[model samples]
Target chain A: MAAAARVFSEKGFGGASLEDVANEVGMLKGSLYNYIKSKEDLLFAVVRPDADELLMKARRLSGTDLPASEKLRQIARVHVEIIDRKLPYVSVYVQEIAGRGISQEWTDMDREYMSLIEKAFMEGVEAGIFADDLDVRVATRCFIGSLNWMTRWYEPGDPVRARAVADQLADVFLAGALARSRN
Target chain B: MAAAARVFSEKGFGGASLEDVANEVGMLKGSLYNYIKSKEDLLFAVVRPDADELLMKARRLSGTDLPASEKLRQIARVHVEIIDRKLPYVSVYVQEIAGRGISQEWTDMDREYMSLIEKAFMEGVEAGIFADDLDVRVATRCFIGSLNWMTRWYEPGDPVRARAVADQLADVFLAGALARSRN
Candidate 1:
């Protein structure tokens, strides 16, 4: 999967050949087919772990008894961590998801996880933990967009920068960037 | 350029053809060459306006006598408004900018505009108009990422929704989502 991700990242999903992936992993083309059905399948195989990890994190965080603010903070951190850990796969996922032949299962999983975040915003607003007038859907997307954008700039193995970005972004999402006194 | 942008948005950059763009604009493929050198040239033609507009806005706003907060607010609105106005071209720009054949001119322009935003953050901090501890580069990218993500969801011709998104996002960038009372 790692080799496939590297191949797809370098040559886009349409441009990458299954043989290139096989070469990267030291497998013969025929042997590769034994493990994956097609190039599309190989692409999905590479990205599924990212989707699974995200859904796993979302479910676990949302299932906890934390307040909405805390939940959002955790969500933000976990999201950054996932992207940091799976940079190659996530990059391919972001670039290719809108293309033809992506699985419905992937889209369904994405929707489910997004709903969990939206639910968090709704709960936050209802509990007076978030602004009452907040548009939960757009706000949820704003939060998601902020974190996902990290993929374009976040470097792998830079734990210091990673932690700083996660903490700072979480702070912004929960409390805005304005100093407390100014607010 | 408009016809090329629509074609590129519908078909990924690699998939789009000069013939397709020519057909959209009611011209012959051979005639398109009279104006564009290649498919890649056509892409740069379509996206150059967005880059030019961004740098133009950034330079103009950064030169203003407005406070950092006001400057940032206007920057946010203008940023979103441009994406709203040029959705198809901007969408192609986001997807293809990192690819192999993209023009250096585009990347240089993008970096310049981003640096302008980073400068805004730095000035804001120096003037005590923003939090003292802000990481100007990351914060600026976060701001850019938030606005750029609108290309994914901002529906064209829906002025009402566009205005709401712009205002809501600007508010978040300036003050964040936490209620002032909570702060």
Candidate 2:
């Protein structure tokens, strides 16, 4: 999967072939077909673990007894950590997920990920832990957007920046753009 | 340009050739080369206008005497309005900008757009208008990402929703996720 991810990231999904993944992994092209039927399958397999990891961790966090705010803070950190660690896989995932040949599971997993955050926002608002006027869907997206945007600028091997982003973004999301006290 | 943008957006910069753009704009493929040298040029031409519009508007806003926070409030609105209005061109820009054949100006304009926001964030902090401890780059990117992320889900012809996003996001950026009063 790591080999396939590097191939796809370097060549793009459309440009990559089964042979490239085979070359990357030192397998015969025919042998590659035994495990993956097509390049899209290879692409899917490469991207799925990262996506699944995010969803799985999000589910575990949601299942916790922690408050919505704390859940989101941890969610933000986990999200940054995974993306920081899996830049190549996540890059291909972000670029190719919108194309048609990708599985419906991609869309489902993405929606569920956002839905988890949306639920947290609703819970926060309901518990008077967040602003009552907050549009849960909008807030959820904006928060996710802030974290996911890191993919554009974040470099791998820079755990410190990623950690700062997680903590700072969590702070920004929690405290918002609003100043703590007016000067 | 509209025709070119539609062709590029539909067929993609790589998939679409000079002939497709020429046909969309009702020109001879040979003649089209007289006006536009390559498919990449056509893309740069189409995407450039929207990019220019955003930069132009941001430059205009920055010249105003408004406080940095107020300037950002308007910047948020303008960014949303432009993206909502020019979804197709913007979509193509976001998707294709990183590919090799695209122009350098694409990256430059994008950086300038963000630099404007970064400057505002810096001014806000330096002038005691924003939190002193704010990570300007992170905050600026987070704010811009919240706006840019709208591209993934924002459907065209939804002015009401666009306005709501602009206002809500601006508020969120300014007010932040912090509660005004903790329970």
Candidate 3:
């Protein structure tokens, strides 16, 4: 699956073939078919687990007893860590090639993930933690956009640097870059 | 050029043919070459002006005497406004298609625009307005990433809703969604 994920990220889901995945893993094509039924199945194998894990983690966080701000911080940290850990899968997931309709699973996962974040913001607004005037939907988009884009630029292997980025992102999302009470 | 921009955004630069662009404008392929030397030139024509304009406007804002926050606000407004006004153009410019073997013009424009924003954030940090701990480059990337992804989701028309989105994005970028203080 990891090999397939890298192939899909590089060649795109539609462009990647069963042979490509097999070659990636140094296996014969027939041998690969024993493990996966088809190319579409390979895509699902590579992408679904990542999405499921993200959705599960996000649900757990949103369902937590912690404050909204704290939840959001944890959510941001987890999001950054996930992207760092699964850059290949996440990159392929975000690309338009994945939207070509081999499976409805990706779309379903995306919509649910978005709604979960939206619900988090709505709860923040309700609890009077986030500003009342905050556009929860748009703010959710901003948050997701900022986090999702990490795959485009972030490189793994630097855990310290990656953690710093995640911390700063959570900080910016919570308190922003402007100093509190400007002089 | 507008037709070409739309075609490029939809089909991608490499995937799009001169014939497709020509057909988009309802022009004969032979006549299209009179205006453009090749497909790459068509891409440059469609994307370059928008990048140039953004850099020009951002440079103008950065050079102003306005505070960094105010400048950022205006820049954000203008950035969103530009994306709103030229969705098709902006969409194509940001796509990987534009990253293909185009002229150096697009590359230079992008760098200048990023440097301008980075400089603005650096100024804010220096003036003790933005947080001293801020990583200016990553922060600038965050800002650009937030603003750039708007092209993926923004719908044309409805100026009021679009303006609201722009304002909220700038607000979030500066102050975030959390209430004034930690409770």
| Weakest ten-residue segment in model 3 chain A by summed lDDT | A94-103
Ten contiguous residues minimizing lDDT sum, candidate 3 chain B: B94-103
Please state the error at residue A150 of candidate 2 in Å. 1.3
Ranking by lDDT: 2, 3, 1
Which residue runs does candidate 1 get wrong by more than 4 Å? A26-31, A98-103, B19-31, B98-103
Docking class of 1: acceptable
Candidate number with greatest lDDT: 2
**Model 1 lDDT, residue A120, Cα:** 90
Q: What are the per-residue Cα lDDT tens digits for candidate 3 across A35-133? A: 888876777777777778888999999888888888887777777777888889888776653333435766677777778888888888899988887
Badly placed stretches (over 4 Å) of model 2 are A15-34, A98-102, B10-34, B98-103
Clashing pairs in 3: none
Question: In model 2, what is the error at residue A21, expressed in angstroms?
Answer: 4.3
lDDT of 2 by residue, A85-148 (tens): 9988887887677322346777788888888998888888888888888777778888887877
For each candidate, report what fraction of the true interface contacts it reproduces.
Answer: 0.40, 0.51, 0.49
Q: Worst ten-residue run, lDDT, model 2 chain B?
A: B98-107
Global local distance difference test of model 1? 0.77
